[model samples]
Target: MKILVTGGAGFIGSAVVRHIIKNTQDEVVNVDKLTYAGNLESLVEVSDNVRYAFEHADICDKEAMERIFAEHKPDAVMHLAAESHVDRSITGPAAFIETNIVGTYVLLEAARAYWSGLNEAEKSSFRFHHISTDEVYGDLPHPDEHPASAELPLFTEKTAYAPSSPYSASKASSDHLVRAWLRTYGFPTIVTNCSNNYGPFHFPEKLIPLVILNALDGKALPIYGKGDQIRDWLYVEDHARALYTVMTKGKPGETYNIG
Candidate 1:
């Protein structure tokens, strides 16, 4: 199958692209806006591959999205384009709202329109998978806040959303839109909310990479929110594998928690 992956130049998105190109026979159409966080260098390994195609475009641009869908004729879409930094969102949220929420809406409509024109067999098999973050579940109780004997509060797939940051809130909104499209329009959509990811090719803006780069420069490692907040971390390649599994085998109108 040909999969059109938005944000395919970003960290995790690039990892997904590499995984698909190197591990599978499927073709990939990489659609990225080349935002501040997007670096084409991450995808250099797969750029020369015959099955890999790259499209430079913003997800929020309706005409660009429609053109990409028409040109690529992808069988599936893995939507991952967004402004993801919480600190950046706190300082400037307009980009987050535009890319995360509005971009998702635009992509959804574009993909839906393309899918609607497909034959019955094609429509039945097409998939639109939206990738989201676990942060939408909001803050969990700190380890110190709970006694050792008490079970630590963990977020499940069914956890209620209570987004704390502008970034998370925007993601939460996009998640809602995916579900609504599935319910209201019978779009073949699936959502996966995953934890923080860290691995090779990660941009320096992320905590682990920032710390690593700063430590190399003899600078003190930075910490946020009392340095006591707990979070889950997943390897980027592992996350890519899980995403491919979901895109190929996952059912529509279903949500999964991935880590």
Candidate 2:
């Protein structure tokens, strides 16, 4: 299968690309905007693979997305592009709205149009997987907020949408857009909301990497609100594998919550 992965140069996206290239026979078309958080160097391992291809483009560009669909005719799409930093989103939310919401809308429309033109077999096999965050489900009660004996819950697949920051809200909005497309237009879509991810190649702005880098430089490790917030952590490579499993084996119009 030929898969087109947006934000494939980003940390988790790059992990997905490497996994697909190294472990499977499928081909990959990496579409990334080269944002500060996205680095092509992460994909150096598979850069020379015949099955790997790269396209420098933003998901917000409808024309570019259309061209990519026409050119690659991919069997699956892994949409991972977004403005993901909550701190950054708090400072400037316009980018999050444009990339997370508008970009998802544009990508969905482009994918729908492309899928409409495919033959029955191609249409049946095509998949659109939207990768999202568990943050869409607002902050869980920390130990400080609740008694220790109380249930420290997890964000299940059926968790209600209650986003806190602009970043999470934009992602939640995009998740709705993808589901709406699936229900209304019959677009084959799958959504996954995973917990925090940590591993190599992570951008320095996020928590784990921020701590690692700052500690190396003897800089203060900034913890948001006393660092008592709990998060279910998943390794990037593991999350990539889970995403691949969903994209290939998941049911259409069925949302699978991956962790």
Candidate No. with top TM-score: 1
lDDT tens string, model 2, 76-169? 9999988888999999999999999999999999999999999998898889999999889897776677778878776788889999999999
lDDT of each: 0.94, 0.91
Compute the lDDT of residue 142 as modeled in candidate 2: 64
Model 1 alpha-carbon miss at residue 12, Å: 0.4
Q: TM-score for all predictions?
A: 0.98, 0.96
Error of 1 at 126 (Å): 0.5
lDDT for 246 in candidate 2 is 92
What are the runs in model 1 whose C-alpha is more than 4 Å off?
Answer: none
Positional deviation of 241 in candidate 1, in angstroms? 0.2
Question: How displaced is residue 112 in candidate 2, in Å?
Answer: 0.7
Residue 218 lDDT (model 1): 100
